[model samples]
Target: MSWFIYALKNYLNFSDRARRKEYWMFFLFYMIFVFVFAFLDTALGKANSMEEALDLEGLFSPIYAIAMLIPSIAVTVRRLHDTNRSGWWILISLVPVIGILVLVFFTVLNSDEGFNRFGRSPKAEPAF
Candidate 1:
C-alpha cells in the first residue's frame, strides 16, 4: 500500500532507481483499482455491454487509466534504471509481442549490484 503511494508521489520522477517491490506493488493496486472502477461504472449504468466496457465508455476506469499513465511509465523507467538499463529501453514496448516480453524480462532481473551508472541500488542498506 505504501509502495503504491510512493510510486504515485514519484509520478513524474524518471531519473531514479525503484525496487522491484515498489514497481510490482503499484501495478497490483493499479489493476485492482481498475477492476473496481470498471465494476462501479457497470453498476452505475455507465457501461451497458461488454463492448462498451472494453471501449472504455465507462467513466471511472478510463479516468483512472489516464491518471495512472504517467506514474506507470515513471515507475517502469525507474525499474529499468534499477537494472542498469537506459530508460529509453521502454521504447521497445512498441516493437510487438517480443518487445513487451523483453521489457518484462528486464524488469524481472535483479537490481545491478552497487551501481553501474544509474545511482545506487535501491536494495542497498544505508551505511551507518
Candidate 2:
C-alpha cells in the first residue's frame, strides 16, 4: 500500500530510478483498482453493450485510468532509468506484441547496482 502511495507521490517524477518493488507494486495496485472499478461499473451501472460499458457514463474504470495515466508513465520511465536505459525505451512498446514483451522484460529486471546517467541506485538508498 505504501508503495502505491509512493508511486503516486512521485507521480510526475520521471527523472530518477525506481527499484523493482516500486515499479511492480504500483502496477499491481493499479491493475487491482482497474479491475475493481470495472466490476463496479458492470454490476452497479446501466449498460446495454460493451461500448456503453466503457463509455464515460457507464463506469469508473475510464475515469480511474485517466487519473492514473501520468503516474503509470512516470513509473515506467523511472523503471527504465533503473535499468540504465533511457525513458524513450518506453516507446518500444509501439512496435507490437514483441515491443511490449521487451519492455516487460526490461521493467522486470533488477536495477543497476550503482548508477548510470539517470541517478543513484534506488537500491542503495535506505528503505523508509
Candidate 3:
C-alpha cells in the first residue's frame, strides 16, 4: 500500500533510483485496480453481447492506465537509472519481438553496485 502511494507521490519525478521492489509493488497494485474495474464494468453493465461488455471494459480500463501513465514512465526511467542505464534505453521496447524481452531484462538486472550518474543505490535505503 505504501509502495503504491509512494509511486504516485513521485508521479512526475523522473530523477533518482527506484528499487525493484518499488517498481514491482506498484505494478501489482496497478494490475489489481485494473482487474477490479474490469470486473465491475462487466458485472454491473450487464451488456447484451460480448462486444458491448468489451466496450464497457474499454471505457473504464483506460482511465486507470491514463492516470498512472506518467508515474509508470517515471518509475521505469528511475528503474533504468538504478541499473546505471540511460533512461532512453526504454525505447528498446519499440523494437519488435525482442523488445519486451530486452526491457524486462533491463528491469530485472541488479542495480549498479554503487552510485553512478543517476544517484546512490536504491537498495541502500528505502525508496521513500
Q: Each model's TM-score?
A: 0.91, 0.89, 0.87
Top candidate (TM-score): 1
C-alpha local distance difference test of each model? 0.88, 0.86, 0.81
In angstroms, the error of model 3 at 18 is 0.4
Q: Write the per-residue lDDT of candidate 1 for residues 12-126, one digit (tens) a residue.
A: 9999999888988988999888778888888889998645754778988789889899999999999999998999999999999999999999989988889768898887863
Which stretches of candidate 3 lie above 4 Å from their native place?
A: 46-57
Best by lDDT: 1
lDDT of 3 by residue, 1-128 (tens): 89889989998888888888888888889878877666666666644444554454455655766787899899899989999999899899899969989998989988897788998897887655
Model 1 stretches with alpha carbons more than 4 Å out: 125-128
lDDT-wise, the better of 2 and 3 is 2
The residue-by-residue lDDT of candidate 2 on 49-71, one tens digit each, is 44565554555877888899999
Clashing pairs in 2: none
Give the C-alpha miss distance for residue 113 in model 3, angstroms.
1.9
Reference-based lDDT, residue 116, model 2: 89
Candidate 2 Cα deviation (angstroms), residue 19: 0.5
The true-versus-predicted C-alpha distance at residue 40 of model 1, in Å, is: 0.7
